[model samples]
Target: MAASLAAPAPAKGAWLETWLAAAPAASGELALVQQRGREALRQQPIPSSRNEDWRFTDLALLQTLPLTAASPAPAALPEVASGALRLNWNGSSDPLVDQALPAGLQQLSADEIAQGLGHTLAAAGCEQHWPVELNHAAAEHVLALRVTSRSQVSLELVSAAGAGLQALRLLLLLEEKAELDLSQLIEAQGSGLHSLVIEAHLARGARLSHGLVALGQADAALLAHVAMEQEPESEAQLSSVMSGWGLARLEPRAVQVDGAAHTTLRGLQVVDGQRIADTHSFVEFKGPEGQLDQLHKAVAAGQGRSVFNGAVRVPRAAQRTNAAQLSRNLLLSDRARIDTKPELEIVADDVKCAHGATVSSLQTDELFYLQSRGIDADQAAALLQRAFCEEVLRELPAAARSWCSLERLLEAAV
Candidate 1:
C-alpha cells in the first residue's frame, strides 16, 4: 500500500484549470501518469490555513497570481567544469546533460522515461500531494539518473524560469552498493511560480549525499519537494540553503524501509526584506536500529519570516532507534519573526529520541567581547552570524560547501 499525507487545500480560482489546459500533450505510459495526476488535482483541494501543516503559511499571494506555463527563450549556456553532469531546465528550453557519463551512470531518454513511468508514479504516490501532482501533470520532460555500481558522481540541476508557472521532476535510482553526490541549484528569475519534485531510491548499502540552494527574484515563489526510500544499511545525507525568494517552501521526506539505516538532514535559511522561507521535513523508521540526526537553522532580518517544522517517527518495530532533532533560529530585527517546531513520535520503548528548538538574537556579551578585541560592531555581528551558519554549511559536500553564491548571500544577510 502507498503512504499518504494530507493534500494542500484546493487552490482558489482557475489557475489549476488554466495551467492544465496549457500543458503540452503526453503519450504512452507517461500520458497515463499525467491523467492520474490531473484527476487527483480535480479531487484534492488547495491547502489553506485550516490545514495544520500550512497554518503558518499564508497562500493569499500564491492564489492571486496569474499562473501560466513558463516559456523563457533559450540563453547561452553557462560554463561548468568537467567531472560532473550538468542539467539545465529553463521551462521552455530543451534539457541539457553532459556529453560524457561515468562508467556506472546512465541518463534515461524520453522513451525510456515513458516506459518506466508506472514504477516511478507508484513510488511517488503523487495522487496524495498537490504540488507533486501538479508537477506530474505539467512538467515538460522527465529527467532520470541511474547508478548501478560503486561509483561517485556529481549532478548539478539548474531551474530557471521566466514569468508565469514552471514545474520540473527528477528521478534518481541507486542500485545495491551504489553511491551519488547531487547538487541542485534553483534560480528563479522574474515574477512567477516554480515547483520542483525529486524522487530517489537507494538499495541495500547505497548512499546519497544531496545538497540544494535556492535563490529567487523579489516577486518569485517556489515549492520544492524531495522524497527518498532506503533499504537496509543504506545511508542518506541532505543539506540545503535558501534565500531571496519572496515566498518559498522546502519539504523533504525520507523513509527507512529496512533495518540498520542512517539518515542526516541539515538546513540553513536566510531571509531579508519581506521574503518568507518555510521548511517542513519528515523522517520515518520502519525497522529496528535506525538512526536520524537533523538540524535546521534560520536567520531572519528586515520583516522577513522563517518557519520550520520537523517530525521524526519511530514505529513499534523500530527498536533501538536513535533520533535527535534541533531547530536554531536567529532574529536580526525586532520586526522579523521566527516560528519553529521540532517533534518526535516514538512507539518503541527501546528507542532514544530527543528534540529541541531555540529562537534568539545576537548575544550582547559575545558582541561586546569582539568589540573589545578590536573588531567593529558590524564586523563582529557578521562574524558571529557566519559562525552560526557554519554548523550546517560544514556538513555539505566539500565542493558544495564553498559555493560562491551561497557565501555571498550569507555575507549580505549579515
Candidate 2:
C-alpha cells in the first residue's frame, strides 16, 4: 500500500480535503476529478458506519485505499469464475468484450458519456457532489458501448492490475430486443486497486441480462458504480454473484425514467474467514407503468461480514407500477454477521409495492428430510443448502450447467 493511500491528516469534517491531500497531483481530466473531490469538502460526507447503510461492514476500511488518479499497469484477466467464468474479462474494452462488437453494439462518444453521467447523478440532489464533478473532470480513455434490442451477445472482461488502481469506464446501451450476457472478473497477483464507472441505457421494448463478479486481495479498494437508465416497455434482469475473499465494495444504482419498464435484480455472495463484502442498490421508478423485483441472498461463516441495502422508490408519476423487494441471509457461524435492509417508497396510490427481509438458520425439517435419504449429515446439509439457492440461479441463460456446477461448489464449501 502506498503511504498516500494510507490515512491522511485528520482534518475534522473535511473528507474531500483529506482525500485530495493524499491524492497525487495530476493534470487534465483526472486532475479535474480530483478538484471535484476537493470541492466536496464543504458538505458533511454521507455518514456511513455502524448506524448507516454501512452498519455491517465499516467503511473505515475504504480510507486505506489510495484515492489517487494514478494509472494502473495493465492487469491480466481470468478465464472463468471460481467454477464458471471466474475472472472472465476476456480482454474486453467494453463490458461486453469482443474482438468486434456486434452490429448493434457501439461505443459512446465523450459527449454521450457527459450526458449520461450528468443526467443520472442529478438524482442525488447533492449540489457540487464529488461523483458528478469527478465524472465531468475526468474522461477516461476508450469509448463506452451499447447493445441494442434482440441482440444476443455473450462477452467477458478480465484484468490483472499488478499493482495500484486501474480504471475502466464503460457506457452500455441496450436497445429493444437486445440480450446481453456480460461477465467481468477483476484480480491481481499483487495488491491491485480498481475503479469502475459504468452507465447502461436500455431502450424501449428491449430486454437486458447482466452479471458482475469479482475476487482479489483485500489490501486494495474496489469502488464500482453502475448507473442504469431504462425506457418504456423494456425489461432487465441483473444478477451479481460476488466472492469476497478480500475487501470489496459495490454500489449499483438503476433508474427508470419512462413507464412500462420492468427489472429483476438479485445478488448472491459467499463469505468465510475474515473477509468483508458490501452491496448498495437503489432503484427509482420515475414514470408510470413500471415494475421492479429484487432478491438478495448471502451466506456468511467464520469472522466474515456481509451487507445488503436495497431501496425501491415509486414517484407520484409512477402510477400502475408494481415493485417488490426482499433480502435474505443464511448465517453459517455464530461469530459471523449479516446486515440486510430492504426499503420501499411509493408516492403513487393504487400501486402495489411490498418489501421484506429475514435472516435465519436452516430448517430442521429440511435437514431431516435430506438425512432420511441415504446421505450423511454433512451431505444432507449441503443438499438442502443447494436447493435453497437454486431459485436465484434459475434465471441464468445456462441454467442447466449452473445447476450442476453450483451443486458441486456447494459440496466443496461444505
- Per-model lDDT: 0.78, 0.63
Error of 1 at 389 (Å): 1.2
* lDDT at position 15, candidate 2: 42
Flag regions of model 2 displaced more than 4 Å: 1-47, 63-99, 123-143, 148-150, 396-414
lDDT of 2 by residue, 96-150 (tens): 3444454665666667755664455454232243333333333344345666557
lDDT of 1 by residue, 88-130 (tens): 6664444644356667788766666665443533443432677
lDDT of 2: 0.63
Clashes of each: 8, 24
